[model samples]
Target: MRRLLNDLKIMLLANFWLIPVIALLVGALFYFVAPPPPMHAKMATGAATGGYHAFAERLRDELAKEGFTLELVESRGSLDNLGKLLAGDVGLALVQSGQELTLSERQRGDLFGLGVMYREPVWLFVRTPVTFQRLSDLADLRLAIGSDGSGTQAVIGALLAANRIEEGAYPENWQRIGGSRAANALIAGELDAAFFLGPAENALIQRLAAEPELRLESLNRTRAYLARLPYLSAMEVGEGMLNMPMDTPAKDIVTLGPVATLVANEDFHSSLTPLILEAARKVLENGSLLDPPDSYPAAPPRSLQTLDEAEYYYNKGLPILQRYLPFRIASLADRYIILAIPLLVLLFPLFKAIGPLYQWRIRARIYRWYKHLREIDLQLYKGEWPDDLDAEIERLEQLESEMGRIEVPLSYSNELYQLHVHLRYMIERLRTAQKRRQA
Candidate 1:
């Protein structure tokens, strides 16, 4: 055991060149590898009770399982969320699909689309017995077009403009109020009709659906609206979709609405796209009442530039490593695993040379003695002896003694023994010659 340990120590010392080589390899690995994706990010969600905020909460919970923290910042609504994303106030935001129309070329250039989360239907709830045939019909009645910077207001404005109902033509009683306040006012008869945008399951939408005095109005010109606003999807709401028992709406209703798209600005890390989208997929996997399973988180309609990572995710599932390993481990592996190929390419030749290098190093310890032996042999072959033959033999005797302390691997012990024999032979030859000369 001790001999084996000593051999190992010698072998290790012989490969001292590996230290710097490995150091350089490690430095290159770090220099080439991409920085790990952040484990924390902020999302601009909507009002505390709004659908965007609700979905963001579920998404946050899903990401937490992977040790990622998703901070949800409350905003007024989708338009406000988009503004926050543009200003770089947050890494991500949920914007109503058609809201992209409001962005300038420069503003759109700075943003990227992750995907759509779900639909936000444009709902028009009117007080009972209020005759409403077209959007122009609302010009003479009280209405809630949604608050400023809210998705509700944006969609309603577009619909009204498409009908050629200019803002100046709207009734003086029209207000920019929505959510619970709009639901309450419509119930109290303060407004003849109110426009809201949210999923059927939103608390306010559900509450309003249950009210007997309110009529959930279905539009007749949905095809026209869809033609004008390409980003809007035509959604079907069955008679009892909101509340089957109550038979809310009392008839099937067709409506036009925009999807809620997940947007990120330039400052957002592209690497996190898969992680965020995967978490969102989990949130929408079960599907809602109106949306079918796996229907959403689809690529945001072609109006926006999709992040490359997000596009990869939608085409292929999670990255190979992320599917089997924890996120932190998977992410690190994903970024640096490719580096292994190049590193191996470099190390293969280096390791291949080690064997010969080690052999030369071990053999050098034995071969150096041959130089002295060869010189004495050549001098004797020419019938010449050193001036002081006795002193020359004494010097060779010292070398032979020192050979005992020299160590080489057992595999090369034969060469060492041969060196010993040559040294002894030289000493004996000089001694024999010395006696003859004295006699």
Candidate 2:
């Protein structure tokens, strides 16, 4: 053990460069092999009082329970949300369904849909009772353009343009209120008409519905609009949907539009994919927001955000675990599997090389005694008592004692024991030769 330690010390001192090299290699391997730091997901929420913000907060709370940190960055609306997502300012965003957005290849590369949350009905409120046949009728009237870069503005802008309602022909009265403020402005008679894109049960939408003076204008041209734009679907706001202050019920109100979607970067980590899906399942599939049971896609729509594994399973009507178990388990198993490969690669060569080298070292030690014995036998044949005869016997005894201490595997133990026995025989022969000389 002392000799082995001395050899190791000498080698280390001579090859100091090896110590740092080994450390750097180990550090680099550890960096690569270790799991990445937990993601701090940034989401672009809408104005504080908007459904986008409310839904984002709900997602944040749900994700928090599962050990994830979600940062909600409030923006104007879905248009701003998409802009943030495309600019890499956020990882996730809430986008309205029928927004007219043209993404460049670079922008498109950064974004993808997780799934639709819920449909946002386009509620157009007009103060005066007029035969509102089409969206073109509001072209010359005072209209709320919604907050700049909002989903409401995006959808209304597209609808007006498609209907050939040129901006030059429209009234000069345009307001930029968003969320609950937009509802407040319309109720206060500050605006002629307001467009709100939110859930039927939204506080602002309900407030407006309860107002006796205000009327919910049915874009009776809903089906025509839907036929023109495939993304938009006509939804009905049922009778008594909103309770009035006077106990009056709002009758069947026909509305138009599409749902809000949860979107993420295309390169989002796959580990986070399940968490997003789980949250969506809790909110949309479990009927947290909607009233009627099972009103969603009987079969998944072939649209944006429907490409996810979880969504695919949801459409197929299977449990989350059944569809996702293999993927989840594979992610976990990869860590251990990665470690095993390198260890096996290193050990195979070490075992192969070290076994033969160790055998050679042991046999060489035993052969040294044979060489000394041969020289002693030559001296005995000369009929001379060499001055070093006693010293040679002592040396042979010491070598035999050293061999007795050697340990090897049980299979190699026999070879070690044989080497010790041969050394003992050589020592006895030398002693015998010495005794004969003395006699």
What TM-score goes with each of the models? 0.94, 0.74
Please report the candidate that would top lDDT against the real structure: 1
lDDT of 2 by residue, 1-439 (tens): 7666754554445445545755765566567775743556898988887888887887888777756789999988888888888778888888887552455556654566666677888888877554466876775566686777888877777678778876566667666666677777777887778888887667777777788777776668776777777777787765655564523234677777767877777545645655666665665555533335444322223444434554554556434452555433544555546775775675577557655665565456456556766776677679765687689789878877776665433445566677677767767877887788789
Write down the TM-score for model 2: 0.74
Q: Which ten residues in a row have the lowest lDDT in candidate 1?
A: 294-303
RMSD after CA superposition, every candidate: 2.0, 6.6
Q: What tens digits encode model 1's per-residue C-alpha lDDT throughout 1-439?
A: 9889989988999889899998999899998788888898899998998899889989999999989999999999877888899888999999999788788988888889999999889899998889888988887789999988899988898999998887787778899898889888899989899999999999989998889888888888888888888888899999889987778878999989999999999989898888888888888999998999888788876878988898889899788888898889988887777888889899999999999999999999889988988999998999898889988999999999999999888888999999988899999999988998999
Question: Which regions of candidate 1 are displaced past 4 Å?
Answer: 375-387, 432-439
Error of 1 at 204 (Å): 0.8
Candidate 1 global TM-score: 0.94
For residue 355, give model 2's deviation from the true position in Å. Answer: 7.6
